[model samples]
Target: MASLTCRADCTHPANHRHLRFVWLYFTTVNLSALDLNLLLVFHTVLEEKTVAKAAAKLHVTPPAISNSLSRLRAVIGDPLLVRRGRGLVPTPRAQELAPRVATALRELERAVGDDRTFDPATTRRRFVLACSDNDQIASVPHLAATLASEMPLAQLHIVSIDQLKASDGLAAGIVDAAVVPTAASHADVHAEPLYVDHGVLVLRKGHPIRAPRLSRAQFNSLRYVDTWIVLGRAGVGTKMMDAFLHRHGLVRNVAVIVPGFAAAAMIVATTDLAVGMPMRVAVQLAKHLPLRVAKIPAPAMPIEMQLVWHARTHEDPGAKLFRALVADAFRDKPRR
Candidate 1:
């Protein structure tokens, strides 16, 4: 079989157009003789851009990946990928076929029940979840414990919610799910309300401003320590707090800004500065610190956290199991 000769710059606009035309020409070629598993190997290698990385991702040996690539090259009648400098780059044909092959594979998996028979105890699938630091602190322990008992072979990869693209990550297969405040708006993204959380003020025990009931004026006069950790696009609870104060023609002084909730708690526990956080989280922190929780002196600012995922994997057994586990872990705990 004659190999297809193409430029290495597969992502070039002109090359992409040419490859689209090539795709039409190759459509009539018999693919029944091709092993479907080799196509999967080709897809992974093209995505990872190196045999070693692809092998690691697929849980296979480097030699296995190389053998699969050889079979794929023979079947596709193209080099498919070529070494460039120290790394490999997909040929124009591979780039053109990549999306189509991935979509076809997803469709085939859906048709075949998408590993509906998945056994968490036996399977070693790794699931990636995106969430903020606070959620990690509050929920990860419970989640890890549950997984250890129920899905010993399964692994969990936690990525910071601030760094995740949410819906886009789900679509690209980078993240299996996300725990975020705002559900992504993409059509393929599905969301479920996980829990409703509310904020309370935290201050050091026996602070000068210590009072059984904080008046709105007292709340506005206090210097505050603000944490900037965000689980979604917007700022953490600050906007809501500011809006409430604005309604009363009042504003609290932000004495300092910290990167995380734990640091904010530490600062509040040792200093006169006050911090507002989720009631459950604040209560949890108070046990170890000389801190006390107080009402926000107004209606509680409700924070609705949600579980989000791509619709494509909604029916996958592992994804379903993970979603259930997350819900159980995050279900509201009685405030201490």
Candidate 2:
């Protein structure tokens, strides 16, 4: 891995000819000898146009920039830049490569910015995300719909994880982001508050609970369908449900305990069992689904949803864009 990283001087007409010979040798001979470092220089020169300006930006001497240009011409097998008046004008090949060159540099910039942060609009990137099935039913859909309008090129791959394995997906880079209910205590990961959703009771449009007076006693006596996992709590929803029942001095006879919210909602809507779920999700899906959400009179149990990513992908443009869009959609008020 020895690299002819950079060179700093080229003046004589004969040296230009020699650089041309190097270019011919690369094209007519082996391409592997072509130096990757020269591409960086070519990108700088392409952006700057002037050798002195590119050198100044790269923190190198003007001759170094020229030598880099010479190497670039050799490796690319093109007179990529031709002197025109006081500046260098790109040849056809250089013109063809400008966009690709710029994109490469931008990727490098992002990688350096924050283990490679991302931008959304201009980035044609795909990100993998692991979330519970409940997220697919709730958090992910709203964000995906928003992104479809704002960033059509940005694609999200959603993987369902029921057993709570947030760290593995992130560490393996298989999942760029994870929307988990619990906060990440891992030092290597970055987690931020996406939003907090309070639990709500979902009943049919004409259910008895929708009456003007809803009582805790009526709630406890009714058969209840519950999910095993509460977004933020461990031991699932059992402990949290117990705490709520304790406040009422009554315990809910659990008719069924399912693995996810969608299931609970499905079971509750068709049957007499009352289902407790995140308020926002219940409300959002209410119009389409045959369900209505009612406020629980006891203490409000809010579940905190967080966005987690490895420290590596925090600064990626696409990741940052998706994160911002998710946050904005879930915020107390939508900005737009």
Candidate 3:
């Protein structure tokens, strides 16, 4: 039993010619009579345009190069290269094959030749991340700043979690990473804790339900703002806020339904609507608005926000750095 592998210095001038030849040879589907030697001979003939030159490069006599070309010419059913006054000119078929070969050779060179350590500061690689609306508010700005300072040449793309359900961007390589709840975690993904947060109810400062503690009945009597998207309604924190309501067979009287925390906060600030949101973001919103915080009537709901990457990219160097930056971004905010 033998194993085959491709490990080559594709940039080495001598090897490049052979790779170019291999690429050219592949275009003709019939390889039943393939011989490695003839492929090299044909490419060398087209490349050097003279047997004497190719032979000189290969450290072989012109007769040997000529014999190898004769075999290739029989299999290809073309003259391949014909003698001019003092050199050779490729036949039309051979000339047509050159461009295709060059394209594949370029791809090959990129894959094997450019194998080196990923340097974040120098790479112009594009990285994609997916997050729901609130998670974006939580991590995007700080991550953007980190990118601007350390990974200046790298590009960042932030997409919504909705795109992931339509197509698995992470496993498919369209998305590099995501900031999501641990419920999305699976065997094929790597999850790293970004932050631990809990939900708090935000309302206008002069609202009627300003009691030191809110009873379930009082909590239900008020109008509420709900977020119905991935992280808004279906998220762990939201479910925790509603847990008490579920247990007591009572639900919040829905007044306004929005897709995100910011929207919920805005609805809560001006109107009688009260929204349950992460305390970290709610605190920030409260600072600039006429908003007041209230403990959620529900028991402790610790939202575990995590950074997730497909196992495919879990060990990628650039991805590792990206993950570190994401972790650093959340680490800056106060934990409730």
In candidate 1, which residue ranges exceed 4 Å CA deviation? 1-115, 182-185, 231-237, 333-336
Model 1: how far is 301 from its true place, Å?
A: 1.7
Q: Per-residue alpha-carbon lDDT of model 3 for 1-336, expressed as tens digits?
A: 001123555456766666666545655645666555455556666677888887655544576677677767777788878888989998898887655444334445465454548987798988898887766776677789888787999998988888764455564445888877777557567887777877677889999788755777878788888887653335554465566568865578887777787878777888888877777787777877899888756665677777888776766788888878877877646231
Q: For residues 1-336, could you state the per-residue lDDT of candidate 1 as single tens digits?
A: 001122244444554554454345445564564656676777777767898887666654576678778867876689989999877998898887876665554444444642449888897989889887788878877888887777998999998876675334564456788888864475567898888888788999989987856888888889999887655555745776678767866577999998778899899988899988888688778888899998867777678898998776788888898888887887785221
Could you give the candidate ranking by TM-score, starting with the highest?
1, 3, 2
Whole-model Cα lDDT per candidate? 0.74, 0.67, 0.71
Candidate 2 lDDT tens digits, 174-282: 5777777765487457887777777777887667666533587777768888678744345565787778768767567888988777778777778878877777778
Per-structure clash totals for the candidates: 0, 12, 0
Cα error of candidate 2 at position 150, Å: 3.5
Q: List the residue pairs that clash in candidate 3.
A: none
Give model 2's TM-score versus the native structure.
Answer: 0.59
* TM-scores for candidates 1 onward, in order: 0.65, 0.59, 0.64
The CA lDDT at 152 in model 2 is: 82
Residue 203's lDDT within candidate 2 is 80
Error of 3 at 96 (Å): 14
